[model samples]
Target: MMNEQLLDSKFETEIFNSQIEMKSLFYNLETEIQSNISNLSDFAFESHTDLKQLIISTNVTLQDNLKALQTDIMQQLQQVTDQNLITQAIITDFKSDILNNLSAIATYMNNNQLSMKNNFSFTNSQITNLNTTMQTNFNQVIADVQNTNMNIKNNFTQTNQKIDTVNAQINAVVTNNQFQTQIDLLKQQIQNISVSVSISQSMTSDQYRCLMIAAWYGSYTARDNYFNSEQYLIYLTDSGCPLLKWW
Candidate 1:
C-alpha cells in the first residue's frame, strides 16, 4: 500500500508543472499585442499635424497677390484722368486764337471800304466843275465872233458910197461945153509944141495925151510959159498925169 501512494504523488506533481508553463505563454502574447497598437496611434497623429501646417502657408500667399493687383489697377486709372485734362486745355487755347485773328481782319476791311467811298465822291464833284467851266468859255467865244462880223459889214457899206460920189464928179467934168472948147485948143497947142520939143521916148502916146489935158484944165498949177520953158515942161512930164493916179 505504501508504494501505491508514492506513485499517485508523482503524477500529481507533473500535472501542476504543465499548467504553470501554459499560463506563462499566454501572458507574453498579450503584452506583444498592446505594444503594436500604441505604435499605430502615434503615426496617425503626426500625419494630421503636417497636413494642417501646409494649408495655412498657401492661404497667406493668395492674400498677398490680391493686394498687389488692386494697387496696380488704381495707378492706371489716375494716369488716364491726367491725360484727359491736358487735351482739354490745348483745345481751348486754339479756339481763342482763331477768334482774335478773325476780328482783326473784319476791322481792316471796314476801314478800306470807307476810304474808297470818300474818294469816289470827290472825283464826281471835280468832273461836274470841269464841265461847267467848259460851257461858259464856249458861249463867250461865240459872242466875240458875232461882234467882229458886224464891224466888217459896216466898213464895206461906207467904202461903196464914197466910190459912187467920185464916179459922179468925173462924169460932170467930161460933159462941160467950156471944157470941150479948151480941150480942142490944148490939142492944137500940143501938136505945135511936140514938133519943137524933144519928148521923152519912155512915155506912151496915151500918157502924153492925158498930161496935155490936165495942164490945159489947170487941175494943177500951169505956169504962163511957152514950150521953150524947160522947168515947166519937166513938171508936166514928172506928174505922170492926175487921171492915172485917181484910177
Candidate 2:
C-alpha cells in the first residue's frame, strides 16, 4: 500500500515537471515569433510599400513555424493537464485509503485496550479473593498453633507439679531409711556389749564392777543428749531397745 502511494507521488511530480517544460517552450517560441513579426513590420514601413513581398514571405514562414510550435506546446500541455487531473483523483483516493486504514487501526487498538482493561479488572478481583482466602487461612492456622502451644504449656506445668510431688515422697523415703539404719547400728552395738558382759561374769570382781560403771555412765549421757529429739526416741523404741528408768 505504501509503495503504491509513493509511485503515485512520483507520477504527479513527473506530470508537473512536464507541464513546466511545456510552458517554458511555449513562452520561448511565442517570444521568437513576436520578435520576427516586429522586424518584418519595420521593413515594410521603411520600404513605404504595403507589398513588401520578401519580408511578407519571411513573416509567413515564421508565423507557420510559430503556429506548429504553439500546436505542439498546446498538445503537450493538454496531455500534462489530463495526467494532472488523473493524479489529483489518484491522490484523493490514496488519502481516503490511508485515512480509512488509520481509522481501522485506531479502532482495533481501542478495542484491544478495552479487552485488556476488562481482563485486568477480573484478574485483580481474583487476586483479591485469593489474598483474602490466604489471610483467613493464615489466621486460622495461627489460632490453631497458639491454642496448641497453650495446651502444651499447661501439660508441662502439670507434669512439673507431679514431678515435685514424686520428689517429695522419694526424699521422705530416703530420710526414713537413714533413720532405720542408724537404729539398727545402735541395736547391734548394744547386743555385742551384752554378750561381752555375760561372758565377763567369770572375771575378777574389780574388773566386772568397773565395766558396769562405764556402761552406766555411757547410757546416762546418751539419754540426756537425745532427750530433746522425739524422732530419736521413736527410732529407739522401734529398735526394741528401751532406756532404763533408774532415775
Candidate 3:
C-alpha cells in the first residue's frame, strides 16, 4: 500500500511540473506575438508618413513646374505679338514709300510729255521758216540769173562790134605806112586797157552777185562808206575782199 501511495505522489508531482512548464512556454509565446504585432504597426505607420511626405513634395514640384510653364508661355506670346506689330509697321512704311515713288514717276512722265510737246512745236515752226527762206532765195537766184544772161548777151554784142572796128583799123593801118608807128602804139595801149577792164569787170560781177545773195540771206553787213566809195569799188575789183571782216 505504501509503495502505491509513493507512486501516486510522484506521478502527481510530475504532472504538476509539466503543467508549470507548459504555462511558462505559453506566456513566452504570447509575449513574443504581442511584440511582433507592435513592431509591425510602428513600421506601417512610419512608411505611411514617408509616403505622405513624398506625395506632398511631388505635388509642390508639379505646381512649380506648372507656374514656370505658364510664365514662359505668356512671355513667348508677348514676344510674338511685339514682332507682329513691328512687321506690320514695316509693311505699312514700305507701302507708303511705294505709293510716293509711283506718284513721283507719274509727275515726271507728265512733265516730260509737256516738254516734248513744246520742243516739237518749236522745231516745226523753225522748219517752216527755213523752208520759206529757202523758197525766197531760190526765186531771187532765178531772177538774178535771168538779168545776168541778158547782160552777158549785150556785152557779147558790144564785144563783136568793137572787134570789127579794131580789125578795120588794123587793115587801114597796114595800107598807110606813114601812120603805122602811131597805130601800133595805140593798139598796145588799147590791149592793155582791155585786159585790165576784163579782169576788173569779172571781179566786180562776182562780188556784186555775192553781195546780193548775202543781203537777201541777211548775212551781209555793209560798212559805213560801202555804197559809192572808190575804196568800195576797189575792194570789189580786188581778189582779197574782206567779206568776213564786214560780217
TM-score for all models, in order of appearance:
0.31, 0.29, 0.45
Deviation (Å) of 144 in candidate 1: 92
Residue by residue across 1-247, what tens digits does model 3's lDDT show?
9999999999999999999999897676656544543443344334334433544564575566556655655665565566556555655655565566557557755767776576877645654665576566556556655655565566556556655655565455335343333334333433433433443333355444533433322211112211222444455456354342332
Tell me the lDDT of model 2 at 42. Answer: 44
lDDT by residue (108-224, candidate 2, tens digit) is 557677765768776456546656765665565566556555655665565566556555654553343433443344434434445444533343454344334334433543344
Instruction: Go through the candidates in order and give each one's C-alpha lDDT.
Output: 0.46, 0.50, 0.50
**Candidate 1 per-residue C-alpha lDDT over 1-247 given as tens digits, one digit per residue, 9 for 90 to 100:** 8997888888888788778876675555444433432332233223223323433453354445445545544554454455445544544544454465456446644666675476867645654664565455445545544544454445445445544554554454334344334434444444444532332244456555554554453432223211222453465456654343322
TM value for model 2? 0.29
- For candidate 3, the per-residue lDDT at 177 reads 40
- Residue 140, model 3: Cα distance from true site in angstroms: 73
Clashing pairs in 2: none
Better of 1 and 2 by lDDT: 2
- Per-candidate Cα RMSD to the true structure, in Å, reads 91.4, 78.5, 72.6
Using lDDT as the measure, name the better of candidate 1 and candidate 3: 3
Runs off by more than 4 Å, candidate 3: 115-247
